[model samples]
Structures are given as C-alpha cells and as structure tokens.
Target: MAPNKDNLFGSKKEASLVKSNQLDSTVKEILASEQMNRERKTARLRELRLEKEALQPPPEPKAKAKRKTTKAQE
Candidate 1:
C-alpha cells in the first residue's frame, strides 16, 4: 500500500522532534566547554581593558635652546 499523508508526515515530524532533542543536548554539552573558554577570554579582555584604562599619557618635555656666550658681549 502506498503511504498516506499522515504516515509520511508523521514520521518526518517525529524524526525532526527527536533530532531537535538530540541537538539540544549536544548543544548543552558543547556550551559547557565553550562557557569556560568564554569566561577565560572575557576575564582576559577585562584585564586588558582595565590596563588600557589605567594607562596615562606621558608628560611633554620642555624644548631647550643652546645659548652662545661671548667674552666681547660681557
């Protein structure tokens, strides 16, 4: 007998539901590791940001000109 619409679509629907559940669990497992890595990267980024914020511009030095001393002038 040829498959009816319900048999075909029903199986497809069940399959998609099972696949979605599996995908959700897999995603949760992957997120565990990714969460740790993300936390570490975020902490490093925070430290770098704080370091950048703490930095100050250096003070400018004064420009000095050379003076010519002559005994005739004195």
Candidate 2:
C-alpha cells in the first residue's frame, strides 16, 4: 500500500489546532476568574466603606466668617 501524505501532514495540523484551542480556553478561564476577583474586591471595599461611614457621625457645617472692610476715603 502507498503511504498517504495527507494523513501524515494533517495530523500535525490537527495537533496544533487542538493545542491552540486548549490554550485559548485556559486564557479565557483565567481572565474570567480575575474579573470575578476584581468585582468581589470592589464590592467588599464598598461594603467596608459603608460600614465605616455608618459608624461615624456626620460632620458639622462650618460657619462663614465676616470680612472686615477698611475705609480709605469713604
């Protein structure tokens, strides 16, 4: 039987395609996990800030000071 050149070369291409697909999936999963972690951290920080604000008293408003006017001619 004659050797099939198509099968011989096709196997290499198939292997590379499979490897690239796996890498793509892995990269996607990593990105998704990082995004989730960032969102979770942001939510936690927001919650902490709210809790801190709730524990603190509201700041008193400052009164405006009157400026002294000096009369030079009038």
Candidate 3:
C-alpha cells in the first residue's frame, strides 16, 4: 500500500489562523483598556472643572442703555 501523506496547506492554514486569532484578541484587549483609561481620565477632568466653576464667583449683570430722544420726534 502507498504511504498516506499529510495535507500540504491544511496544517499551515490552521496554524496561521490560530496565530492570527491570538494577535487579533490581543489587539482588541489593548484597545479596550486604552478606551477605559481615556474615559476615566475624561470623567475625572470634567469633575475637577465642575468643582472649580462652582467655587468661582458669578459674573455681574450689565445695565441696559437708555435710548436718546430725537428732535424730529415732538
């Protein structure tokens, strides 16, 4: 009987697919962590800004100007 041979591309394809999947998962995890950190920092900065605004005095209101009378108008 002739000797059975392994698939030329089958094993290679499976190994490549496994490596690709691992790489993809690692990249996704890293991106997720970065997103979380960015959101947390944004929230903290926003809170600090709000606190600062609360401690500051409000602006004074400006008075409305009176209109001048014209000679043409009796």
Candidate 4:
C-alpha cells in the first residue's frame, strides 16, 4: 500500500472546504450570544441597584440640647 498524501501536508484543500461555512456560522452565533450577555448584564445591574435602594435606611433628625450658665462670686 502507498502512503496517503492527505496526511503528509495536512489536506489544505479539504480543510478549507469544511471550514469556510463553519467560520461564518460560528461568528454569527458568537455575536448573537455576546449581545444576549450584554443585555443580561445590564438587567442584572439595574436589579441590584433597585434592591440596594430598597435596603437603605432613612436619615434621622438631630436633637437640640440646652446649656447651663455659671454665677460669679463678689
């Protein structure tokens, strides 16, 4: 039996034929997935901000105090 030429040089023609279609599909899928991730992240940040606002405590008013005066001896 003779040695196969496809194995020696790594079959450039066959590789190109299969990968041409695959590259476009993979790129489209990745862009769509990244868009979804960005939307999800934005939603999550908004939810967290709302939750933090709800959890905060309200400010309290300050009280006034009276001072005492000392008398002088003659």
TM-scores for all candidates: the values are: 0.40, 0.71, 0.69, 0.45
- The best-first sequence of candidates by TM-score reads 2, 3, 4, 1
Candidate 4 residues 14-72, lDDT tens each? 88977987998999999999999999999999999999988988657767677777788
Residue 64 in model 2: lDDT: 94
Candidate 2 lands at a TM-score of: 0.71
| Native-to-model Cα distance after best TM-score fit, residue 57 in candidate 3, in Å | 0.6
Local distance difference test, candidate 2: 0.93
Cand. 3 Cα-lDDT: 0.89
List the candidates ranked by lDDT, beginning with the highest.
2, 1, 3, 4
Model 1: CA > 4 A from native: 1-25, 57-74
How far does residue 1 in candidate 3 sit from its true spot (Å)? 14
lDDT by residue (tens digit), candidate 1, 1-74: 68998776777778899999999999999999999999999999999988887796656797898899878864
List, residue by residue over 8-67, the lDDT tens digit for candidate 2.
566777889999999999999999999999999999999999999999999999999999
Backbone atom clashes (below 3 Å) for every candidate = 0, 0, 0, 0
- The 10 consecutive residues of candidate 3 with the worst lDDT sum are 1-10
| Tens digits of per-residue lDDT for model 3, 1-74 | 44444354457678899999999999999999999999999999999999999999997898889999878966
Worst 10 residues of 4 by lDDT: 1-10
lDDT: which is higher, 1 or 2?
A: 2
Query: Highest lDDT: which candidate?
Result: 2
